[model samples]
Structure formats: structure tokens, C-alpha cells
Target chain A: MDIRKLVGGNVARLRKKTGLKQEPFSEAAGISQSYLSQIENGHVNLTLLGVNDLAQALGVPPIELFRELSEMNPD
Target chain B: MDIRKLVGGNVARLRKKTGLKQEPFSEAAGISQSYLSQIENGHVNLTLLGVNDLAQALGVPPIELFRELSEMNPD
Candidate 1:
């Protein structure tokens, strides 16, 4: 299901929807801008802690980050 | 909010509920049993991809792992 890409794309989409820049958002999320950029680019694996931090920073539930995941087949 | 513990506890609970042991479940999830054990103990950080893989192995949606997350205050 390309979970990394799904999460990365959603993170970017939601961050943009909130009108937040990577620098400030990453600061609020307790991560560096470069790391957040890597996450947004699907070039990094985000820890569960990272997911919660980013979700909070984006003013959304962690589940919201997986909004596009229903199309996947777990098998 | 202790996200690591939250996810770890839930993962263990769901795994037990499914009647699968760590060895088989870890194999199905494509992770090492030791790594899964660490995750189950809340001693490891799980990436988004890891979360998805575990959720799929557990036969649930990724969000299900965060079922108890509503009590947290993002702020």
C-alpha cells in the first residue's frame, strides 16, 4: 500500500491545509524542518511518536493522517 | 500521552485477541520477532510503515491501534 507515501502525502496535504510552513510546524512538532521535509517527501520513516507529534501540530487526530488508507488491501 | 506505550499495549492486546504468537505474527508482518517484542514492550519507536504492517497483520485498520488516543490533548 506504500504506507510511507500515503502518510507523507497526507502530512503535506494537511500541513498545507492548515496554512503552516514546515519550519514553524516542525518546531511545534519538536522535530527539525529538514526531518519534516524528509517526511513530506516520503524519504523517511516516521515513528509513532512522530505521527502523534505531527498530528497534534496539524490540529488533527492521528487517524486523520491515514484518511487515504482504506483503499489498501492488507493481504 | 505516552504514545509508545499506548501503541505497544494495543498491539499486544490485539495480537493476543487474534490468537497469534509473536513468532508467527512477526513473520506475517515481515518483521523480526525480537523487533516485534520490542514494539510490544513499548521500547521501540514504530514507523508509519511499521504501524501499517502491524495493523494489516492484526486484521484491523491502522487507526485501530490508536483507539484509546482520544483522551490526549494535542495542545
Candidate 2:
């Protein structure tokens, strides 16, 4: 699976677990709501710091942003 | 702890675990040896895809590049 999609899914799932909408959650995340939308949609190649920021806002480990990853065979 | 440093340390350690020098390792990672050096030194804010690429090159899950990450308490 694509890493972006994986991250996006994890973020979305975690955000839902918080029961906060994108708008409020974006505020908590210190990013724009649209950016949060993009993030949930897997449209961003976020910087490492960006990932950390999101993880912090989400109250999860940065690695949680990449939960459920299986080793890929690079082609 | 800084996420970059954590990631850099993980990469550096994993690369060493492979017992390959920077030149060969960089080639496997499909990045310049100098770029690898920067990554290993925590001097780069690599894009999300870049992280995945590095993980693939290292023959590990992309998340392994972020192993040992403890959730940061967003300040």
C-alpha cells in the first residue's frame, strides 16, 4: 500500500477516535483545515517535521502515523 | 527528542546492520552518498515519499525508519 494513503488513513482513523471534526482538529494540529483535508485525502508528502507536528496534535507517537506498515519489496 | 534525529539514528543503525558502507548503501537506497550522509546526520527534512524510498532501499518497512519513536508532548 502507498505510504501516503497509509498515513492518511491512520490520521483519519485517529482523528475520528478523538471525535473532532477536521476544522477543530486542524486548529489543534496547527495547520489549516484545507491542509487537514488534503492530509486525510493522502495528497501531501508531508515533511518529517510535519509528521511530527501531526502526531503531536493527535496525541500519538509519530510512528503511529505510519501504523500497520508491512515491509515492501522495492522494485 | 527530535524526530529527525530519531529517524537519522535509525537509518544509520539499520544501514550499519546491513554491514554495507555508505557508498554501497547509498546506491541501494538510490540516493547520493552525500544525501545519505545528510539523512543519517539528521540534517534533512525528507519528504514522506523519500522516507518510504529509503525504507525500501534498506529492505525494511518504512515505519522501521521511525522505530523507537516516543510520542512527543506537543509544546
Candidate 3:
């Protein structure tokens, strides 16, 4: 269902909401700039590890990312 | 931050909250049972697509997961 697009969009939205740039977010999440960009662009497949890192960096749980994505584009 | 444990716990909680088993959730999310199991146990990584699928199947936004997780385990 084009989940990548949904995830990418959500990441962008959250990053903006928290006033964090890709670099800082990546640093906080312990991810690479390229990987984070890929996620933001729907160009990568995130592992549970990746999402977990993101959750921690964003001060939320991993599921929060998915929940936000769903809210953004509900059925 | 042991994001794995957090994600795994959240997945388990959600599954239980919805009265769903891993098999049904895997089917709904279009993921494999093994993969879903790993996620539930903090043994696998999750892609944006994976999270999106779970969100869609669970009828919630991606961020809601993180929020719930936070509520479950505050800082």
C-alpha cells in the first residue's frame, strides 16, 4: 500500500514538528545521513533497529512513528 | 536505549489490546510470522513500509505508537 511513501511523509512531518534537521536527528538516532534521507524519501527499508533509534531520538516509542503515519493517511 | 525491547513490548501490548494473535496481525500487516515474531521480541528491525503496514492494519497513525509507548514507559 505504498507504505514507504507513508513512512517517509510521516518522518518529514515529525522531524519538522520537533524542529530537528536531518543531521541532528540522524545523530541522535545514531543513523547515517544517507539512510535517514532515504527513509525520508521512501527510498529505504527500515529495520526494527532503525525505527527504534528514531523513536528514542524523537523521545517517543517506535510505534508512534507508525501511528502518526496512519493518522496522516487514514483509510 | 534498547529500542528493540521498547518496540517489541509495544507490539505485544497492541496485539493483546486488539485481541489479535501474531498470525492474524502478520497476515493483516502482510508480514511473515517469523518477522512479526522477531519484531514482537525485539529481535528484528522495522522498515518504514513495515511500520506503515502495521499502522494501516491497526487503524492508527504511526506516531500514536510512539506516544503510547512513551505513556507506557515515561522518562
Per-residue lDDT of candidate 1, residues B13-68 (tens digit): 89999999999989988889998999988887888777888899999877777766
Query: Alpha-carbon error at B43 in model 2, in Å?
Result: 0.8
Recovered share of real interface contacts in candidate 3:
0.94
Task: Name the candidate that leads on TM-score.
Answer: 2
TM-score of chain B of 3: 0.76
| Candidate 2 per-residue C-alpha lDDT over B1-75 given as tens digits, one digit per residue, 9 for 90 to 100 | 788888998899889999999999998777899999999999999889999988988889888888773433343
Which run of 10 residues does model 2 chain B get worst, by summed lDDT? B66-75
Poorest 10 consecutive residues by lDDT, candidate 3 chain B: B61-70
Indicate whether candidate 1 or candidate 3 has the larger TM-score. 1
Ranking by TM-score: 2, 1, 3
Candidates ranked by DockQ, best first?
Answer: 2, 1, 3
State fnat for each of the candidate structures: 0.94, 1.00, 0.94
Candidate 2 to truth, TM: 0.89
Interface RMSD after interface superposition, model 1: 1.4
